[model samples]
Target chain A: MFPEELKYSKEHEWVKLEGNVATIGISSYAQEELGDVVFVELPKAGQEYKANDEIGVVESVKTVSTLYCPVSGKVTAINDELSTQSALINQDPYGKGWIAKVEMSNPAEVESLLSAKDYQSQLAG
Target chain B: MLKKTALYKNHIDLKAKMVPFAGWEMPVFYPAGIIAEHKAVRSSCGVFDVGHMGLINIKPQTSNIKKAEEFLNKIGTNDVSKLIDFSCQYSVLCNEQGGVVDDVLIYKLIDHYIVVVNASNTDKVLAWLSSHAQDIEIEHLLDMSILAVQGPRSLDVIEELFGEEFGFNVLKRNNFLQVGNILVSRTGYTGEDGFELFIPLEEIEIIWDKVVEMKVQPCGLGARDTLRMEAAYPLYGHEYDEKTTPLDAGYSWAVKFGKGEFIGSKALSKEKEAGPKKRLVGVVLSEKNVPREGFKLFNGGAEPIGEITSGTFSPTLEKPIGLAYINNSCHEKNISVEVRGRRVAGEIVTLPFYKHS
Candidate 1:
């Protein structure tokens, strides 16, 4: 299930924009496909990444997946709890499972992301 | 085209995640997820639909146990003479060049021997055995389906299913008992005490349903892999292939050179004397990084020394553990695995990252 207030990327990342800060995490579909989340490699704070950059890594018991930055910006904060409790991604993908918070370099990039309805359609297709 | 096992519909009904495994469309996990399924097998009871594995029946023309033992000894690496009636022995089939064909379990029935091969290498093992046949009938038991009941409470589940009169309590490890058409062997891939039931294809669904009714968690290939890895068991194509020998895989105990000459005996014997060029070792990463198959291993050197064969996050240990074929020359304490172009520090620990108490 996807949230209506969030913007999604083709790589299955969901972005929540509040002013210039965008909270990013993987969608519920991605977490379900990954099964049990065992390890999450979060990017360091104060690191700059462009939109669509490979920012971090998320590893399930079966395989590893790359976390892509939705909007280009400098990472302001990361969820340190994910270092020990990666399964939060599976438990609550949209809430407590948020991976990183980034200060957006260009707020216009949010328009390029898929809307909740469009993302649902993309998943269906 | 992918093949479907007899329990394919059952897997679908359980809302399992189906994946292609060794030419068969098998369930990788159920809705309970891999970690839950894995933990169930370790702590409680778990049933697995292992019907995809191949079963080959070898019967001597003379029906003599001695002749049958002789025939099996020529095909496998273990000492077939030591196998008693209704007992099973883990053995490896090898090519003449000392390379492994497939690891198998030889179940010696009263007058015949049943060889269980991996699903992927079934055709090849059948062909290999047929070509090497001498005054023996090799029949592939296609109608037979295997179901494994594993974990600490496995015996209780078996007793409840077949009733107390079956004498499941007396069934020793690596031993089997036939009840009607089904053959229940006290052997399993999981490290826990368990049984593998070789049942008729038509009766598998009923037995599976009965096991499920008893609240036994149904496991899939994903949990099976993790369980075996935690037990440090070698899987075909991951630990050993046509290029590797049993000694190379740290299974020299399975290869009995004193049992007389068998396939690859000469080469394996020489390798044992000369010492193996490579040794399979268990690795535990210090960090949370999951080392995957084919990931290169380094010993604080610029060049890669070996590569990972099987790796996963140990649900029991809650750490990343793997089996790697490292060069014997690189005997360094600081072993690191190259994961995504970054070196994660690890140590070569003993085999079996987790052991059931």
Candidate 2:
């Protein structure tokens, strides 16, 4: 189940916007499909990125997947705890496993992301 | 289209994540996850649907033991004579150029020998045997299915199911016994002690359901890979391929250099004298970064040495482990692996990253 407050991407990432800074992490569905999260690579703070840019990577024991930015922004902060406790993504992807915080370069970019209902439909199909 | 085994429906009923592997649609893991299944195999009993492995029975010609011994020795790298009755031996089928065709397990029965090969290389191995072996009756038992029940508690589960029919106490490692129509062997791919039961396809579901009823964890290929990697067992495609030999995979002991005429014996002997191009070694990462297959390896400095063949996070050891074939010159401790363009410090350690005491 996707949270109503969050916007989702087709790549299974979720974003939470508070004013111009948007918090991002992979959805619970993504983590569940990934089985166990063994490692996470997040973009460094102050790094600028465009929408759909490959910002980081997440690795399970069997697979490696690239993480894409859903909105154009500069990385204001990243979850440092993921380096030691990547399982947090599998345990609680929405809360403690939040990957990064970006200072949105274009506030209008949030409208391009899927709503919770749209994300649920996408997963259903 | 991918082929499905007899247990495919059962895996789907349990909500397993299915993936295509070696032409078969097999379960990669279940909801309990890979680490949980791996721990089950290491700590207790776990049943794997290895139905894809090929079972080839080489019946004796004129019931002559010498002929069977001679035929097997020609194809196998390990000495077939060392195998006692009801025992199993690991060997590889090599080409004339000393490259491995496929790794196999030869089981010596009372009247015939059975060779178990990788599912993907079954046809290739059969063709190789057919061309080299003369007058030996080679029967590909495709109707049979294999179930690898592994761990310390494997016999306990087997005893619960077939206690009255068979005795588990006498089945030593690398040995097998017949119970009714099934062949139960004390051999497994995992380093853990277990039994590999080769049973008829029609009756396999009965044993599979019974084992599941006893709460033996039903593992998939995902856990199988991690467990074997932790045990330091070389996978066919990962460690050795058509161009890689046993010696290149750090299995020189399996190749008897001075043995009688056999396939690749001459080339292997020459390579032994001249030295191999690369050597396989176990690498343990000091950082938490998980090194994956094809990730580049470097020596203590920036000089690129080789690449990783198989890698995973060892659940038992609680560290990242990998297997790589580094250049012979960089055969030292304290190497580095480049994952995503960043070098992570790694130390070359001995094989069998996890061993049961």
User: Highest TM-score among the candidates is held by which one?
Assistant: 1
Q: Can you write out model 1's per-residue Cα lDDT over B1-357, one digit (the tens) per residue?
A: 999999999999999999999899999989898999999999999999998899999998986777778988998999988988899999999998789999999999888999999999999999999999888889999999899999999999999988889899999999999999999999999888999999999999999999999999999998999999999999999999999999999898899888789999989988988999999999999899999999999988798999999999999998988999999887886799999999999999988888878
Predicted candidate 1 versus true structure: per-residue lDDT over A1-125, tens digit per residue:
99999999999999998999999999999998889999999998999999999999999989899999999999999999999899999999999999999999999999999999999999999
Instruction: Give the clash count for model 2.
Output: 0
lDDT of 2 by residue, B61-132 (tens): 788876888899999899999889888999989999999999999999878899999989998999989888
Worst 10 residues of 2 chain A by lDDT: A32-41
Which whole-number lDDT from 0 to 100 does residue B282 have in model 2?
91
Per-candidate fnat, comma-separated: 0.79, 0.68
C-alpha lDDT (0 to 100) for residue B153 of candidate 1: 93
* Model 2: lDDT of residue B351: 88
lDDT of 1 at B81: 89
Candidate 1: list runs displaced more than 4 Å: B62-66
- Candidate 2 runs further than 4 Å off: A116-125, B300-302
